[model samples]
Target: MTKELLLAAFIISVGLCVAGAGTHFYQWRLRQQAMLRYDGATVFASMGNLVMSFFCGPYIMLQMGWSQEGGASVNMGSALLSALVAFGWAFLTGLLIVGLYVAVRS
Candidate 1:
C-alpha cells in the first residue's frame, strides 16, 4: 500500500477507536449517575454503545481473504491481533479521558 493509503487507514482506525471510547465513557457515566438503575431507552443505548465499542477494530483485515476462491475467510491470528490492538487503544483513550475529567473536577 502507498504511504498515503496506510496513513488514511491508520487515521480511520484510530478515529473509530476514539469514538468507541467516547461512547463507552458516556454509557458508563450515564449508568453511574443512575446508580445502577436501568431504563428501557438507557438499556438500548448502552447496548448500541457496547456493539460500537466491541467492533471498533481493523475490520478490513478480516476481509483480506474475501477475494479467494472460497467464501470470505478470516485469519484467526490477524483477527486476534486486531482486536487486541483496538481494545488497547480504546482502553487507553478511556483512561486518559476519565483521568482528565477527574483531575479537572478535583
Candidate 2:
C-alpha cells in the first residue's frame, strides 16, 4: 500500500483504540463512583460520549481543512461521510470492549 494509505489507516486505528479505552475507563469510573455493579445506562452513556468524541476529533480535523495530502480542501460531503464512519467504528469498538468485559466478569 501507499504511504498515505498506511498513514491514514494507522491514524484511524489509533483513534478507534483510544476511543475504546476511553469508554472502558469512563465506565470504570462511573462504577467506582456509584459503588455499584455496572448497568446498562452507565454503559450507554459511556459509549455515547466515546463515539461522539471519536467523530468530533475527525470532524474538527476536517473543519480545519486538514487532509491526508497535507493541503486545505473543504469537501463537506466527504467530511460528513468520514465523520459518520468514524463514529460507527468507535461505537462498535466501544460496544465490543464492553461486551468482552461483561463476558469476563460473568
Candidate 3:
C-alpha cells in the first residue's frame, strides 16, 4: 500500500514538473524571439522551482497518509490541496522571475 502511494505520488509529481517545464520553455521561446537579449537564467530558475515543487508536493502529500488495519489510504483532498499549494508556489516563483527579468531588462 505504501509502495502504491509512493508510485502514485511520483507519477503526479512528474506530470506536474513536465507541465511546468513545458510552459516555462514556451515562455522562454517567445521572449527569445521578441527581445534582443533575454535572460536565459529566468527560465532555468523557474524550472528549478518546478523541480523543487515536484519533490515538495509529493512529500507533503505523503505525510498526510493514514494507516489502517487492512490497507493504507490517503485523502484525495489532501493530495489535491498539496498539488495546488505546490503549483501556487511555482507560479509565484515564475512571477518573481518575470519581475526580475523586467528589472534587469530596463
Best candidate according to lDDT: 2
Clash pairs, model 2 backbone: none
In order of TM-score, best first, we have: 1, 2, 3
lDDT of 2 by residue, 16-68 (tens): 66654554565576563221122346878666555545533433333333244
Worst 10 residues of 3 by lDDT: 31-40
Which ranges in model 1 have alpha carbons more than 4 Å from their true place? 1-18, 21-71
Instruction: Give candidate 3's TM-score.
Output: 0.33
- Name the regions of candidate 2 deviating beyond 4 angstroms: 1-71
Candidates 1 and 3 compared by TM-score, better number: 1
Pairs that collide, model 3: none
Cα misplacement distance, residue 30 of candidate 3 (Å): 34
TM-scores of the candidates in the order shown: 0.37, 0.36, 0.33
Evaluation by lDDT, superior candidate among 1 and 2: 2
